[model samples]
Target: MTRIRREVLTLPAAELGPDNPLPALRPLDEVHRIDGRERTDLPADMARQLGHEPLRSLLPARVRDGYGRTRAPRALDALVIENDRLRATVLPGLGGRIVSLVHLPTGRELLYRNPVFQPADFALNGAWYSGGIEWNIGATGHTTLSCEPLHAARVPAPDGGEMLRLWEWERLRDLPFQVDLWLPEGSGFLYAGVRIRNPHERPAPVYWWSNIAVPEDRRVLVPAEEAWHFGYERRLSRVPVPSYDGIDRTYPLNSRYAADYFYEVPDGRRRWIAALDADGHGLVQTSTDVLRGRKLFVWGSGPGGRRWQQWLTAPGTGGYCEIQAGLARTQLEHVPLPAQSEVSWLEAYGPLDTPSTGEWTDVVGAAEQRLAAALPRARVDEAYAAWKPYADTEPGTALAAGSGWGALEVLRTGLELPGTPFPESTLGAAQEPWRQLLRTGVLPEPRPGRPPGPTPVSPPWRDLLETAPATAHTEYHLGVAQWHAGDRAQAVRSWERALRRAPEPWPPLRCLAVADQEAGHHERAAERYADAFRDLCRDGHDDDGTRTAAVAALGRETLEALLRVRRTAQARSVWERLPAAVRLRGRFRLLLAELLLAEGRRAEARAVFDAGFEVADLREGAEDVGRLWNRLTDEPLPARYDFRMRPDTG
Candidate 1:
């Protein structure tokens, strides 16, 4: 039998005593779970109408319905077994133990369970859902990991007038494990947490963290100047791309990239945190406890066959965000304490509309401020400045040729924009002529008498060619111009050429895919689409706008092509990768249902069709699809016809 070891850390009393500045929670026992209706104290009938149900019964019904049959033993039996195992083999050693943290070798940390409620199952809209796990630390210091019957429950409206029923649950488990499990309520968000308590007479050194999985297109930003170590062998050999897969690992204090920033606290305290997302929208924030001064163990998946680097891309179907808080490993070692000490940790989840650094500073305070202050901005700037000389030199120029121009242009544009925003009139005046020339390839040359403020050039290809090698974007744009000019062959050539010189390959690959698709080279288009998807998925963890846009664009293109080819099966498969809400839309679920019906899978098709029809009144695009659906099934239609056009028009 494998020997089980409980991981324990201790800290001194001076750093985190009872008088510590952080908010305090009542002892663990005071924490309890209450159903929403009960917490709100609604009347009996009102509570029933509100869909209040016991939390423990939530998942069994969902499991039964999902499997479409009643089992000899109730579905909750499995949960009970698992719960028992958690309590027996995992919880007792760690639960309520101040500073004693128990985690599976697989990384699932066993924490405390809510005394008031356990996981439960409920019903909504004839569908089963789960709910009822509320872990409390005290007022203003608790989190409710509930999975209620969203499909039937009426939530309070922003205006306090009416409410809406969003989604029904299927299954839920509030455990510290890394898997691609999603809740219906937080559709695009992955849920994971760690409960830390300092119960010792002194403060205990502890760092709380969550290892989140993300699609590749996302970017990772840290305060480190250089990577602490490369986890995957492949990533060590190559320059990292936004979409490269393999773990691009970082510590609390390395600084190698332009966007990296350190989280510092005054008087030698370090509270480093980082966020990840494909689009700027899905943000994951990770932080370390300043008091503990522990070092964080950060790892990510990279591209290709590397162990550590997994490039996270935005799902071709959807995306998500994550947030975590903990103590740094380094700090844990520096201040090992006696038994019975305690430490606290906190993190927040939501959209990334504002800067994460400021928020971290506000929450973690001095620790965050010091890290931000310690950032070597001057050194970073000096390094970039120093590189400019070599970058402009012949060897540097050659190295950056083709795709370099676009990058330089963008860099220059970024530098210039703040000082002198582009003139609106100039942009507007140049837009049409630029587009016209790109399309027709027939425009008058610059007049000898005229100067060069912003006049359209004749034979724009020459000027464009001059800029293409520097940036893959220029090559991609030129390729688009060629396609617009009805030179499909040239378009393909331009895109391919761009790919050869493109540093990142993504922009050109996207263009190449589109060009191939337009030229009826379906196989080639598919290959390029697949490549783009892979790249996007690998880097989907970055909290950058560009990555998000690229991922979404690639997904849209791939899905649209699959639909056009009447490969509804393929389309549906891709659609399933997206967020449930997105999949619920007409263009996805309804289309897939229609395709299923066309393929003679009537029962399955009707189920999906019915779901879409029920939501037809709620969603905008569903109405037309629903109407067409009625016509197809209720009134007989020809065996084969163009479904893109309406029957009335036909």
Candidate 2:
């Protein structure tokens, strides 16, 4: 592939001229100025102060004319410093690496860039061809297009020396480009366009789109025939997708009148366009002719989060519409593209008087007519009707029901306890007894068998449990209630039953482990905890590894509890069976060393403590580990030292 180069320049436009038709263009300058202000000169004092810190010393200093000076710090040093500061302060602690710069204020950041091509292998090559494009306010109200070669920028050490190259293009026509506009903070209007000419002697096969992402809750109104395609995986599929892998297939779109729509255009078309609802909201349209067809895509951001860029619905979320100009899915095998042929043209007409619809055969014509028409009055009748149910309800019932789950029916049909053989009245009587367990620190006698006599006539719990064996959630809830009611044995049984029927592993594992721990089954509790940790680890839970370490720590605690009862031999045997990963953990190793010392094995204890100190030092990488080693080796404690400081504390 040939390398593609981008030309960067400021847009030349004065303030809106008297003859300009679009009055909304006047605010472009203000929006540009606002965005540019985010890139103001960095404070030199702050940079120097940060440079003195150990962890933050990696931040680079600002360099003036860095490229021409041979020994100067790279331009990327300033960028990295700025980004690191933003990550440590402005953004949540989650760090994001900067990738490409489109403009000073706007660019393609790896973590928070516009959802064009995701940062996949295909995107790496595609992004290089696309270049860094930005649209900002010009001297006039008109927008300017700024472009920069992504590879030209220099990065600092570590990441800087890596050989990252942009995709090469022989001619500019081989590249497809679009202008991205960052919207202002408040409600306003923005427009985007692409001017492409087929410089090739023969028409080039083309597939182009203006992908707009919106929030999940925002409703879209599009014209359709009998049914429209609904994207299952947000923007990829038109039907219900079984998994993320099956997102490529398109299904017939079917949605309420409020659902967004994607219009599929047949191949071999030249020009296509669409408009957005006129309330001065954003809109997007696309035209493509790769498979001898044209496709148009559109959607809106549902109600939530700040709206940033065009088609951006929320801060970190959005949906898309794909307008295709090609043969239908059925006719793909029969269609063939002419060599070196032009594909299609896409145009977006925003700030329309009404919502965009498929009913119009000529969208541009309809858009022009709508633009001439007066803006319609805002209506609240439908909204009022939707909210009428809450107003008409009785105050008592309304107050009692908090939300969807707090409805009267849900309250009346309370949770069911599993493995409990008791009447509703007997269960109710046990509530106070359960509460007494926590206060008095006493365990109730286990029931030998099922309770005597017939089951209670008003046993709502038995009916609910028997009828819905799969109600593991209810079983767990009831177990917690029983634990609080002073029936420790019954709580254990209930949690066991819940684990047997629970669909997922997490809830049941947690309930069972807690029940065993409370029931004085230390070894059994450790086993259950380990099982839960392993299961969660296999399922990609974030805290799985941490939880596994915690389980090992708990096992050590359990051993200490056993030793308190003079079961030293049993504790030693249990400790020997622990997993290697757990045994090497800082807390577990410390406990093991202490346990060896308690057994009067001084030399063995010394060895264990030495190993533990090394592990702790490696894991924590702090001076405290060295101090701990000295203390364990019989060095006198420091006079002012506080032994109670936490291991994790700096």
Tens digit of lDDT per residue, candidate 1, span 365-422?
Answer: 4333433443322422332233222211111000000112212222222322111112
Question: TM-score for every candidate vs. truth?
Answer: 0.27, 0.24
Best by TM-score: 1
- List runs of model 1 lying over 4 Å from the truth: 1-462, 467-471, 501-506, 542-549, 563-573, 594-600, 613-632, 635-647
lDDT (CA) per prediction: 0.30, 0.29
Stretches > 4 Å off in candidate 2 = 1-493, 496-557, 563-566, 612-634, 637-650
Worst 10 residues of 2 by lDDT: 57-66
Name the weakest run of 10 consecutive residues (lDDT summed) in model 1: 16-25
lDDT score for residue 368 of model 2: 37
> lDDT for model 1, on a 0 to 1 scale?
0.30
C-alpha RMSD for every candidate: 27.5, 29.3
